[model samples]
Target: MPNGPTRYDTVLLGSPVWNVLRPPMIMSTFTEALDFRGKTVIPITTRAMSGLGTAERDYTASCPGATLAEGLAVRGEEVSKAEAEVQTWLKRIGLPPR
Candidate 1:
């Protein structure tokens, strides 16, 4: 939420999954600082072993009124090789690779 206008078309929310969930701090801080009424939220989570699990669900719940996109779950070990996958996901979401 950094001191700025409280509006955006899209938001990329990244975090590391802990115990099959997003850290509690993320949930509290983000929800408190930002309002997601009309934003498109794309959640990305990094995990060492567990997969996405409830990360997407948690993000959806956190951003109550936002449009939730298909979330991306990246394995910590594959992060180095995830460029293509990340690009694909970006394309699928109507965003060109940068």
Candidate 2:
């Protein structure tokens, strides 16, 4: 069996965009299998250029009633330098910096 589950108010879902628009098929499968209702769902993306792509729409559809928070999209090569940006995003979403 897996470890004990922890409760949370927010979720960060991440994926690398495929073909400059869509997230990988695995993302769709993963999201569809989860229950995100009433939570703050935020999408994180590692991209070459196309921003958050269709993550916002995809999550909105898959996670019914979830509060869609601002998503974070970082350059694929710049993930290591995204700490500050991520912190800011968390704050903006009413979460304390971790």
Candidate 3:
């Protein structure tokens, strides 16, 4: 709330291959991007194999009120094979198919 310009109830973060230096900063900026007081912040990080690494830590610290949920680790090389999985995940997260 202190850093954000506006408040957001829920945040869904999906990233694959988080650049080494960019990931932390991205997470920090995201934290600063919105206020999460009394809101549920769902952080989902997509990775090739590392899954969710320090992203969880950074998000946790940035959004103290957030309920840091389990993340989904997607393999970068297998994106094509994971379309169905992606669709399922999108559906689970309330994103209707196009």
**Model 2 C-alpha lDDT per residue in residues 1-98, reported as the tens digit of each score:** 02111277788888898899978988887777777767888899999989999999998998787889999899999999999998998889787898
Residue 24, candidate 3: Cα error in Å is 4.5
Between candidates 1 and 3, name the one with more favorable lDDT: 1
Order of candidates by lDDT, top first? 2, 1, 3
In model 3, which regions exceed 4 Å deviation? Answer: 1-8, 17-24, 87-98
lDDT of 3 by residue, 20-97 (tens): 412546668767566665555555555655666676777677776767655555666776687788678767766565
Model 1 agreement with the true structure over 1-98: per-residue lDDT tens digits? 66322666888877778876554565546754767777887878888776665766776776778788887889988999999999999999898798
For candidate 1, the lDDT comes to: 0.75
Error of 2 at 1 (Å): 11
Q: Which ranges of candidate 2 are over 4 A from the true structure?
A: 1-6
Per-prediction TM-score to the true structure, in the order listed: 0.82, 0.86, 0.63
Error (Å) of candidate 2 at residue 6 is 7.7
| Winner by TM-score | 2
| Model 2, residue pairs in steric clash | none
For all predictions, the C-alpha RMSD in Å is: 2.3, 2.8, 3.8
Backbone collision tally, model 3: 0
- Model 2 lDDT, full chain set: 0.84
